[model samples]
Target chain A: MARVVVDVMPKPEILDPQGQAVARALPRLGFSGVGEVRQGRHFELDVDDTVDDETLAKIAEGFLANPVIEQWTIRRVDA
Target chain B: MARVVVDVMPKPEILDPQGQAVARALPRLGFSGVGEVRQGRHFELDVDDTVDDETLAKIAEGFLANPVIEQWTIRRVDA
Candidate 1:
């Protein structure tokens, strides 16, 4: 089996309230120096060795990420 | 400034319904050969150069992840 990692992040133009909440709470929690936080989604897929990169990309784009508001990257990782 | 990436994943024993939903939908969507899908959270932090690894680790563990149910890994990445 091959392992594929897909990272989906909100588009740069989008507002991420969850990330902003973290950035705001950091200073109050005694952790400083973090300027901005952007939260996103990560997916790990266990696929058969026969599954090719194109198929993985299709799965990532068509299923794992929403193209309208989010962007995604796909890469094969060591199993 | 430096970029820090924090990946938070549910503990292996925890049920991931979101991931399961995707796994179940993939085959229905005409994609096959994918055995399992695990979904998690990804965070990108813009931090001052002064923020040390120890502090970043604390931020990831104390805030970004629920120690009781999730596990996290922290790494510095090229900006």
Candidate 2:
């Protein structure tokens, strides 16, 4: 089996309220020096040996991320 | 400014319904060969030069992840 990692993040121009909330709460929680906090999604997939990188990319783009608002990267990782 | 990436994932033993739902949907969506899908959170933070790796680790552990159920890794990435 191969392990694939897909990280999906909001596009730079997109608004991320969840991230904003975290950024705003940091100082109140005694954590400082943080400026912008962008929250995103991470996925790890265990795939059969038949799965390839191109298929992983397809899965990331078509199923995991909304291309209009979020961008994603897919890479094979060590298990 | 420095860019920090914090990845928070559920402990291996924890149930991940979100991941399971995605896993179940993939085959129906014409994607196959995927076995286990684990979903997690990804965060990118723009931090001042004053913040160090240790501090970033503290922020990830204390604020970003629930220690009892999640594990997180903090790393510095080039902007």
Candidate 3:
């Protein structure tokens, strides 16, 4: 099987309330000397090796991600 | 600066409808020899090296992820 990964982070220009909220909360929670936590999501996938490149590319573009809000990269995890 | 990564996958027990739909769509999109596309996200960050481990750990758990629905890992994106 080939492994796939995708990540989605907030647009840089967009207000990242979650990241800001976390930044504000961290100090209160006893985490010192840390600031500006930008938050995002990550994914891991196991795909059958028989899957070819074109289809996986389609999957990444059409279904796996919303391009307006996020950017993604795909790679086969080497054995 | 240290780079942080987090990945979250749908629980295996839960149905991945997005994956199933992508699996179905790929063939229609003219990609052959493909099946079962599981999708997820990836993240890249440039974190200050002076930030200690404990704080980053807390960021991973408290802010970067929603542990109930996702699982995550963190590593320094080595220079």
Candidate 4:
């Protein structure tokens, strides 16, 4: 089996409350010098070796993520 | 400024409903032959140049992820 990783992040313009909450909490937790934080989704897939990059991209774009609000990248990882 | 990515994923033994939902949805959306899907969190951190890997990992462990049920990896990315 081939391992695939998909990183999906919201468009820069979108407001991410979950990220903001983490950013705000960091300072309270004594983590200083931290900058902006944006949160998104990460997906790991175990697929057949026959799956190609093109097919993975289609899966990421068509099902794993919503193209309208987020952008995703697909990469193959060692199993 | 430096860009850092923290990938947080649920422990393998944990149940991931969100991932299962996606896996189920994929076939309905016409994407077939996909295997198990695991979902997690993706975080992008913009930090000062002086921030070292140790500090980044600390932030990921102390603030971004829950060590008990999830595991996280920290890496630097191109700006």
Candidate with top lDDT is: 1
Query: What TM-score, computed on C-alpha atoms, does each candidate reach?
Result: 0.98, 0.95, 0.68, 0.92
lDDT of each residue in B22-46, candidate 3, tens digit only: 6677677766555455554444555
Q: Sort the candidates on lDDT, descending order.
A: 1, 2, 4, 3
TM-score of chain B of each: 0.97, 0.94, 0.72, 0.93
Worst 10 residues of 4 chain B by lDDT: B25-34
Candidate 3 Cα lDDT to native: 0.64
For model 1, what is the alpha-carbon lDDT of residue A76?
Answer: 90
Candidate 4 lDDT over B17-61, as tens digits, reads 999998888879877777899999999989888888887888888
Off by over 4 Å in 4: none
- Local accuracy by lDDT, each model: 0.93, 0.93, 0.64, 0.88
Which of the two, 2 or 4, has more DockQ? 2
lDDT string, candidate 1, B1-79, tens digits: 9999999999999999999999999899888899989999999999999999999988988999999999998999998
- Expressed between 0 and 1, the share of native interface contacts present in candidate 3 is 0.42
Interface RMSD values for all candidates: 0.6, 0.9, 3.6, 1.2
Task: Quote model 4's TM-score.
Answer: 0.92
Task: Return the number of clashes found in candidate 2.
Answer: 0
